[model samples]
Target chain A: MRLELGKIFIKDVQFSDETRVENGILYINKEELLKEVSGDERLRSIDVELAKPGEEVRIIPVKDVIEPRVKVEGKGGIFPGFISKVDTVGSGRTHVLKGAAVVTTGKIVGFQEGIIDMTGEGAKYTPFSKTNNIVLVCEPVDNLPQHEHEEAVRMVGFKAACYLGRAGKNVEPDEIKVYETLPLLEQVNMYPHLPKVVYVYMLQSQGLLHDTYVYGVDAKKIIPTFIYPTEVFDGAIVSGNCVSACDKNPTYVHMNNPIIEDLYERHGKDINFIGCIITNENVYLADKERSSNYTAKLVEFLGADAAIISEEGFGNPDADLVMNCNKIEEKGIKTVLVTDEYAGRDGASQSLADSTPKGDAVVTAGNANELILLPPMKKIIGHVEAADIIAGGFAGSLREDGSIEAEIQVITGATSEVGFGYLSAKGF
Target chain B: MKLKPVILTNNPLTKSSLENKYSVLYKKEASLLDILMFARDYVHKGHRLLTHPLMGSIKPNQTPFKSVAVSKECFNDVDLLSLEIIEESILKAEQLIKSKKTPVYTDKVLEDFSLIDFDLIKNALN
Candidate 1:
């Protein structure tokens, strides 16, 4: 499969009377984009705001962040399963609104929604702070259940992104990068001398705000399966998890999975990038055992000499990580595991819930439990009071002065397990 | 409910050592709640246990002991309590104990207590 990613570098974003991209600036027609997302009756009100890099703006209780992309020459549209029809994508040209993002925030969907600070010390920790964000603050109808609210906001974000993506349809791309991976047998045959490598991508699917969708199917229902490395670029997977904000792979991360990109960078040169084996992190022990067993079998079946395993969220999924590592290594396949830590507030607690001697090559994505104070921003986009109840936040998290004292877990993509951000942890 | 005598140890000893020193003394079947209640009483009697900065010493009165003084390496085969299970058990036990009734520790609760979810219960032993 081959994917041509045409990047249109967005220097800035602003609301104007018409929605269009010109001179590297994205001008969004607020009323038009609002019309696209307002179709959902679940939302009581929807407002769009612009938050640029280096601004003193804070988007709280952010549900998801997505980069706007439009399928130009693809077999299917972007976001194959959810926003677009359930079609096999990832073999064509797609245009990206590079450096711009759609940030969905509103009333708290669950205790796991995150905060994206545009500037200050907090900005350094989150990748979203660098993007020119089109912040969607959508409030659901009164007394809506958290699950329903999460679903509503999640879909709205996609709609807004898709709507904004249309702005890049006819515009010429600033740069075009092509990525391809042949069939497993062909790939191995072409790069016979190179070591065959596979990527074991774990999705959080523990149910109720901890779920990921593959072609719009709930991930928990699916077993381990193989996908082309390029398919992820076309949005083969979407995150539904509201887990700890720091580690959860939001939609943007899913679209631009760093492990896949990095591995592709060295493909055929250092290693034969076979493909990706996607699996779920189900809560049940039997499911965990089955998924890990199938993942190992798949990697072995692919004749992979080595593999990289990445996890989403933490805690319960740690078992899955260890199992994947141990099982794959038991089959003589060298594995490198990527994950974040919850080493308590002081960074002195055990990093993971599970461990095995076989997990020798591991990449830590920083400690999510480390405490940090986010100074008050000049303007707040969403509800600031959510800081008191969100996961990784305590009762006194939001002080009267508007500053927040909370763990890094409250910040979006602060410790992305996929190596999306530069933050990482080390042994003292 | 007749309570069994429980021992609280603060030594940097393995689970086997703690068991060898105290398990025999409290051999009678007792739920974790019973042991925690005893620990609270022991602390009330002016005993102090070493505590870690992140994970403080376990206080009997505080159900779902946030931080315990034992080191992570010392938790081998001890059925150490995780925060999730401890919190759940404490909520149930408090209701029962408040009514002056013996809390029935079900197999599910016991299993949760025995199997620690390390991710959810990090720094359990500082």
Candidate 2:
């Protein structure tokens, strides 16, 4: 499949009378955007706010971050299954409102949510701090179950992103990037001399509240399967999990996956970017064994000489990561594993819960356990009081002086295993 | 049940949901470590560990509850892979638990953790 992504650069976002993009400014009619994302009875209230780069704003307990995109010409619309019909996507022109994102913030799973600081010492760790954010503070109606609340908030982010994406429909893009992944035989033949390289994509599908979707179906229900690299750019996969904020691949990262982009950049030159094999990280040992075995089979089936395996979340998924690495390596495929560390705060602890000597070529996305001091921002969105009980926080983590001392795990995309964030390691 | 007989868990939700279909050993006050250690003992006794001990994204120290699926029947020989995994998971859990900043969840938050812990193993119970 082939895709032409028209990039509409949005440098600034502000509430205006009309909702449109003009002169690189994304003007939002707050009322209209809310209406577009509202009507979910489970959500009692929805407030739209904007946080630009270098602002004194903090979005707490962020659920998911999504890039606003419109399918100018594609087999299917954006967010297939959730927002659009489940038609096969990944062929045609899609307009991306790049540099801007829709950030969903609330107490979905309470402690597992993330925080995004627009301008502060914390901003350096998260990629979202750089994006012009359209913040949705969604409050669930009383007595809403966690599952339903997660569903309601997840939809709001998708709907608002879709609504805002319409602004880039007719407007000409600042730049256009073309991404294509042809049939296996053709792609391999196109670069016959180059080494065949494939990507083993692991989705967080542990269970409810830690789920990912492919064509709107819970990924836990699907086995390891092949996917066109371009399909992901067209919104074929999305994050529905409220895993720890630091490493979860928010929908925006899926749309602009750096690994895919980098591989494509070297496509036809250094290596043959054959395809992507997506597998779920289930909570079952049998499922883990089955999925890893299937993943290895698919990698070997592609005749891939090498593979780059990336994981989402940590702990339980670390086992999945190791199993995939070992199985693929045993199949004679050189594997490069990308994951973040939960090493001790002093960086003097074992990195992964599981490991394989076969995992020789590994890329570390820094450590999630490293502590940081985030000076409180002047403006706060969502609940700030959640800091003390957050995943990376302890009792009294939120200081009375408005500053927070916690692990980078509380920061969104701080240690993104997909290599999406700024924090990573370099061998001395 | 595909692999059944024992659902070693601390979450009542998982036990209540699977008790009829499977033999559940529910421990109401069991910590994450306790549940894993019990699963290890069962593994040593020759019962197969069905699901991954570390199921949820919640770190062992972060969430107080855990539910492990183990086989009902026991053999004279223990599964080496099961033993290795349960050990590694326990080791990882221990490291995090000793990190010196464990979470102290309130009753409301504990309920959320209970559901999350249950959700992680619900599909694996099958």
Candidate 3:
């Protein structure tokens, strides 16, 4: 499979009469975009607003962030099995509204959502801060159940992104990059001298606000499977969960996974970059055992010499990571694990809840418990009271002056286990 | 045949909805630590853990409710791996609770927490 990604670099976003990308600036039609997400009976009301980088704006209780892209020339539309029909994607040309995003906001679970400040200390921690954002502030209908509320907000993000993505249909891309992976036999033969590498992509599917979806199917319902790395570019996988603000992989992260990009960079130069084997992090112990067993078997069956495994969330998923690592290593396949830490506020606690001697090559994505102070912004989107009730927050997290002091866990994607985050360290 | 699973929980939603359907050991006045310790004791008695003790990404101290499942049948010897995980979960919950005070939740927020906990473990219990 091969994919050509056309990047339309967006300079700025503004509310305009028609929703379209013009001269590198994204002009959103608020009324049209609202209508795009309207008619959901679960939503009492929905509103859209623009937030740009370097602005004194703070968006609170954010649920998900998604990039806008259009399938200009592909076998199927974007975001398969989600807002779009389920057709096998990952081939042909796609146009991306680069540097622009759709950020969904609502109080689904008080502690489940995260914060994305467009500027100030909090801005640096979230990747969304750098993108031109279309913020959706939604209110659930009176007495709507929490699960229904989560589903309502989750679909709005996808629908809004799909609506916005149409703007890039006819626009020419500033730059285009092509990615291709041949059939297993041809791929191996294409890189006979290089090491065969595979990626163990773990999806979060524990429950409710802790679930991920592939092709619109709840990941918990699926077993370990193989997928072309390029398929992810067309939204073969997406996040339907938002647990901790720091560690969860939002839809945007899945579409633009950094690990897949790094592997492609050295595809022929160093490693074979054989496709990716996807698995889930289930809450049941037996489910974990079953999934990891299949994952290791798939890696060995692919004749992989090495694999880089990335985890989503922590704690429960840590057990899955350890199992995948140990089982694959037992097959004599080298593995490199990618994950974040929760080493307490003082950084004195053990990094992960589970570990094994086989996990020798590991990369850490900072600590979720590291403390940070966010300065107050002049303008606030969504609700402000959420600061005190969020996961990393305590009773007095929201101060009288409006500033918030809590762990970095309150910031979205601050410690992304997929290497999408900016925090890391060097061992000296 | 698979042995019936025993659920140890402090979540109101779980008890109200699942009690009639499954065997539930509901703790009315238990903190996060209490339920985890209960699961640890069950594991120490040779009951294998069915669900991950630390199931949700929501930290142990942040959410007030918890629900975990353990096998009803017990062996003569304990499963050390199960004991280790439950012990670590208990310690993490204790440390976080001791370091910071749990939030004084609003009535609506409390319902939200209960719903989330039930949704996470309802499949396992069923």
Candidate 4:
């Protein structure tokens, strides 16, 4: 039987570049079609190939035709604004609260106990960890899935650390309690102070060879960090050049997925494949609902440690709720969201403001030396405005998901090793 | 159900140019699968080894952050994988294309298919 076929190309207005949108049917002629679809800038570039009346046309499929979406993008404040200092309470000892972290108007805010109460959408802090001074609002235990329970617990750990930091009035670097969910199997000795990351992924998604890229940032430094997943995918044949160059003393995790481990051993790249570690016994089914549940539970299970949910909930409604939970305050913990593409202006503004308050200053990335000639950390701890950072050889681009995506090349700068800047009200 | 499949040719010209010289939404989805399987049937009818595959896999966590270039070799052995997984996945994806598909296509039986779910897509070594 003969078939009629056509294709559609969708180009986002934000970029001048063209993108093809497939699975569209064309009922008109290609010649007449060019004039019909070619006028608007967004639609200006398109290519349509229709089969002859009798020609047999083959159809192909692409995933994510429709999925609940979350946009991850990041933009640093270029101009500095009003700056204030945080008052170090109790001479090194202050009890904190339990609450999640949030971003509002380009600031990251970490609140203390009983500061605010918010549900899914209202303007309040989200809990990144659990705290002793405050209560953590969690998915009701009855209706709670196993995953949400885990996330709640994880937040508890983060909150506990924040509380101890306040109570002890000092938390030694080694004494600080940090929970890393990323699975790291290959351990190379480099920065001893670098926190270990434990990656938790779905078992079904595990492959002998694959290419995976991860972007990260030091919460304290607020700078970007990147990682890749090759052994988990199938045969890792990554095209990009930076893939291999960045693997020096890389930190990765391999789980007990023997099938996947075997595949990586056979077909994996030349890089070192380290040993495996046992975290949660539950296997991620690789289903959406299950993945969401796993992610929520992972965050909850961390018990007051930093919970980074990258893949599963990037653009779901869960993102808003997960990113907005202020339970960290009640728990007296600190939280940060590593987003690659954020939503619109309102969501962006809210996320930024929620993550940091006005007085807080953005420190030099990957640097231990604190900034001098600047106000005290507390006096301007949270009151800072947006920050404009120019580092690495490459320029940074802000994504819709509120994450920074850039091909950054490290360069030697005069001022700070990584570069530190302020984001106060005066700059805006 | 009738399907509409698009053929992506090596002839770069055959690939849509208006967008970034490549095709999107052709990897796996309800609408795309509905169309791809129909075309695969045609390829099967010819009884020839379909060397070049017209479809590929898409990651669930995938976003428009950066454009990914898929290997053409991955397309060669798609039939080695089960089609049932792809077919079953369409049912669960009902909410995604509710506005785009015909009402008759709303059969709940489609939900029974999960193997073909987008998140299930993986790079096959065979």
Candidate 5:
């Protein structure tokens, strides 16, 4: 598989009479974008706002953040199976609005939705704080179910992303990055001297609010499977899970998995970089055992000498992580686990609910339970009262002056388990 | 159901502590029967213990032990009991034995012992 990622660097996003990309600026006609996303009758009102880097704006109860990318010359379009027809993507050419993002915010679906601050102390934690964000605030009709509201907001984000992606259809790319991976046998033959490695990618599939989709199929029903490294880049997997705000792999992180990118950088050099085996973090004990067993079996069958397993969400999923690590290492395969901590507010409790001695090589993505104070932004994009009930928040989370005093878990991507963010924890 | 001894303890135990003890006993090449004997002695000393089928013995402090144990029995018809279940069942039995709300487990509670997941004993019998 081969992919040529064309980067269209977007420096600023502003509302204009016409929606187009000009000289690194993305112009959006708010009315047109609103109409495109407000097709669902469930939504009472749709408002589009531009939030650029260094802006004094805060987007709370954020559902998902997506990068605008068009499949310029690919087998399938961006967001395959959701907005686009399901075709085998991850090959050929694709153009990305590199510095621009579509941030979905609306009535809080679950207490787990996140907060993205464009600037100020809160900006330092989230990667979306840097992107030129096109904020979509969709208010649902009264008395709508939580699941329906989430689905409406999630679909709108994808729709808006696809719409913005069209602006780069004709624009020439600033730079193109080429990534290729040969078939399993050919790849092995090419890098026989290097140690063969596989990535055990765990998806949060604890159903209801916590779900992930692969080619429009619910991930919870799918057993352990293998996918080409580039498939994710083409939007093969998307997050619908509303886990804790800090660690859940949002759609943006799914599209740009740092582990895959970093593994590719070391591919053919330090390691063989075999393809990825994706498994689920199911709530059922049988499913956990079966998925971990299948994942380890597949890694062993792939002839991988080592593997890096990345987890999504904390708590019950920690059991899945340890199971994967222990089973893989039992096959004489070296394993490295990537996960974040939930060691309470003081970072003193156990980081994970589960533990195994086999998880020796582990990378912590920092503690989600650490407390932080977010000063009031000049403009609030979504419902401000939601801060009081959101997952990492207490009764007094939303202060009288509009400031927020809560755990870092309320902030989006503060403790990304995929090594997406820079925050990390160390024992004092 | 065959008579299977369940150790009920006053204090909850962490999985790490249980795992550490298991590792030590495992390094000494303790057999399943030997581990059960040790658990019996531990229970006699008033410490909680639960033996699982696949997960070995878990302390049950952190996990959803009560739900896992109940579901295992309801679905599999097995006696894969944990320490938490034994404690709860014993408490309930003691309440019956004393004919009061508060549990006062005398030797009467032991006489009326019933395992949670009967499958463990059934499989052993088979």
Candidate 6:
């Protein structure tokens, strides 16, 4: 009988008739050990040799006893859903979820000792604070009111609004200011107003690489920022759960990825949220059908849990109506429309009512100002500790099935200050 | 060139800044030199900050010059990584330069590089 130990084998053990006393303890015979070792069938390859008494008692096995093991060889698999990676080492090696390769080098901490020593430094520098909570969100040009736009500029330290120029046209700073100054959002009467805080998006003139770049703003008076390139893995751009860019203004800056849960953790239940005004309308571009497809893809890409849209009768009525309905349905996001019901003798909403697939759509009535105040939103009634409020644009032109999408933007402002608002899309 | 080094403790001296934000033992502004001075005064009159029986202090001059040099060694690799970080950090610095051109500070345009921990690099290599 032979005994296997990992890759090693032992055999040729002496068999003692009985146990003997050695150094005040009883020592078992090698023959009994060999019998126990060969009991398993997996050890059949091992051949144990037993030695007689006075013959240097020893046990030996004939075969190597290496155990079989399994391991994944390469990066050949895909993760099914949103997974996050974090680096433990101070080096750039980051740990990916459901995978082995490090995602980044900056997040990792290198040595345990070094970490202990430097951990005090981070605390000394005031790494965390509560005064810098802020969130910035952008809206279309025509949606925001004039007064509110000026307020936005003063509050967030910049003007914000949609770009109303032709794609490819040079966007001057003055021209950008025009859209940025649209007073779009009405401050809700439920919270204390932080004079210098607002959330808005921006349309940078990237020349020809892409049309417009979008991002979530997390603080006020923060120098302009950029994200850690969100990966475009499988045709769709993957926005990481985090955002970067905090070196702008040292005094009033915040850093953290704008994932929903992170907002909850920092603010807990004491969140001050403002209402989101979505601009609702459907139009076209150089290629109407192609543009529609791109819009649909963007909706899916944003992946908001739910949204509210307003579609207006702006361009090609039939195509725009159908386009809105088709786009939102494709994204599979829950939607509610706050537009007027088209009044016909037959009680139908619009000419394309039959053509537009019916599901869950709301139709409104009255003048534009009346429509603005129509359908008082009950969701934003109580959670109004909002320091920032983001509004949307025209939404009546949508067909019965068309829907718009939006997100709840919350920022870890420059300290512990937080800005909460909603990001929405409508006019094209 | 000889390197100048400073050692800080969790303690704060009289009217230290850390006292405003955090609770601390001893003097917050107390440096290695201050600690030495306090020890000398204590030896003259039998007063001491540390009297735990098992604790002791080694003067800077009493320490072997080689040991003083040893402490400097701790920064060599860190300095190297800092250089690499500075080199790699150029792209972000350029971005900041570009962003500064705009009058308004946009959250979307700033780079949160402070979130990057450089200590991680040395720890990994070690």
Cα-based TM-score, every candidate: 0.79, 0.98, 0.98, 0.23, 0.80, 0.19
The TM-score that candidate 3 achieves is: 0.98
Give DockQ: model 1.
0.04
Model 6 TM-score on chain A: 0.22
lDDT (C-alpha, whole model) for all candidates: 0.74, 0.89, 0.89, 0.20, 0.73, 0.20
Let me know the TM-score candidate 5 reaches against the reference structure.
0.80
True contacts preserved, each candidate?
A: 0.00, 0.64, 0.69, 0.01, 0.00, 0.00
Docking class of 5: incorrect
In model 2, where do residues sit more than 4 Å from their true spots? none
Q: Is the docking of candidate 2 incorrect, acceptable, medium or high quality?
A: medium
Each model's total of backbone clashes = 1, 0, 0, 192, 7, 101
**Tens-digit lDDT string for candidate 6 (A1-428):** 01111111111112256433222222234354334223222111222221221221111100000111111111211111211122110111111111000010011111000000001211111222111111122121343432233222222211000000011122111111000111113322222342211111111110111011122221111222212111111001111111111101111111122222232232213432221211111111112234345444544443333333332221122233344446656667544433322122232223222124533553332211111111112121111211111111112311233211111011111111111112122342
Evaluate candidate 4 and give its CAPRI docking class based on DockQ. Answer: incorrect
Per-residue CA lDDT of model 1 for A219-338, tens digit only, reads: 988989999978888778888776578899999999999999999999979998999999987654456678999999999999999999999875457777888998999999999999
Better of 2 and 6 by DockQ: 2
Give per-model CA RMSD: 11.0, 1.3, 1.3, 26.9, 11.6, 33.0
lDDT: the better of candidates 2 and 6: 2
* Best candidate according to DockQ: 2
Give per-residue CA lDDT, model 6, range B16-110, as digits (tens). 53334322234334433344343333333422121110010111111110000011123212333122222222222223223222122123211
lDDT of 3 by residue, A1-428 (tens): 99999999998999999998999999988999998899999999999988999999989898999999889987988889977789899999989999999999998766556899999898988888999999999999887877788889988998898899899999989999999999899999998999999999999999888888899999998999999998999888988787798988989999999999999999999899999999999988888989999999999999999999999987899999999999999999999999998888887777887888999988988988888999999988998988888879877889999999999999999999998989876672
